[model samples]
Target: MENDSVEGLKKYTANNLLDFLTKQIDKDLMAALVKELGGTVETKTNSESF
Candidate 1:
C-alpha cells in the first residue's frame, strides 16, 4: 500500500510536489490553529522559499 502511494506520488513534477506539500501544511496548520502556539504559519510557494 505504501509502495503504491509512493509510486503515485512519483508522477508529480517537482513544482507540483512542492505545491501539494505546501497546501497540506496549510491544512494542518489551520486544523491545529497556530494561535494555540502563539505563532502564525506562513505557507510559501516553491519560488518564494528560494
Candidate 2:
C-alpha cells in the first residue's frame, strides 16, 4: 500500500512538471511569433485605439 502511494505521487509530480513545461513552451513560442510580427501587431492595436 505504501509503495502504491509512492508511485502515485511520482506520477502526479511528473504530470505537473510536464504541464508546466508545456505552458512555458507555449508562452515562449507566442512571444517569438509576436516579435517576428512586431510592426504588424503594433499597427493593428494602434489603429484599433482610434
Candidate 3:
C-alpha cells in the first residue's frame, strides 16, 4: 500500500492508517499517544526514506 497524497492514509486499512499516522506525527508525541492507547512505540530515526 502506498500513501501518495496527504489524505492517502485515510484510504488504508485500520492498522495501516494508524501506522501511517504514527509515521506522519512527531515520534515523541506519537509515542506518547501510543502509550495512552496502551500501545508501545519504538524510538526510531526520523528520516523520510524513499
Candidate 4:
C-alpha cells in the first residue's frame, strides 16, 4: 500500500486517488470536509477570507 512506501507518500487530491480505493484524511489535511462533518455550508458569502 502507499502508506508503507516513502515514494508513494506524496500529497494527492481527491481526483488523483485510485478509482477502486477510497481514502479519508483528517480535517487538518482536508479542510473542506468540515462542511459535511460539522453540518454547516460555510459558503463564500459568509465573509471569511480562508
Using TM-score as the measure, name the better of candidate 1 and candidate 2: 2
Model 2 ranges off by over 4 Å? 1-22, 39-50
- Weakest lDDT window of 10 consecutive positions for candidate 2: 36-45
lDDT of 3: 0.44
Off by over 4 Å in 3: 1-18, 22-25, 45-50
**Which pairs clash in model 2?**
none
Clashes of each: 0, 0, 0, 0
Candidate 3 — worst ten consecutive residues by lDDT sum? 9-18
Off by over 4 Å in 1: 1-32, 46-50
Backbone clashes in candidate 3 total 0
For residue 8, model 3's alpha carbon misses the true position, in angstroms, by 23
Report lDDT (Cα) of residue 37, candidate 2: 32
Q: Is candidate 3 or candidate 4 better by TM-score?
A: 3
* Model 1 Cα lDDT, one tens digit per residue, 1-50: 22436654433332233334445755554523333323333444542321
Which whole-number lDDT from 0 to 100 does residue 9 have in model 2?
A: 57
Per-residue lDDT of candidate 4, residues 1-50 (tens digit)? 23525543333333233322343333234444333233222223563524
TM-score, prediction 1: 0.22
What is the per-residue lDDT of model 2 for residues 1-50, given as tens digits with 9 covering 90 to 100? Answer: 22546656544543333334445456444443344432122222354411
Cα error, candidate 2, residue 39 (Å) = 7.1
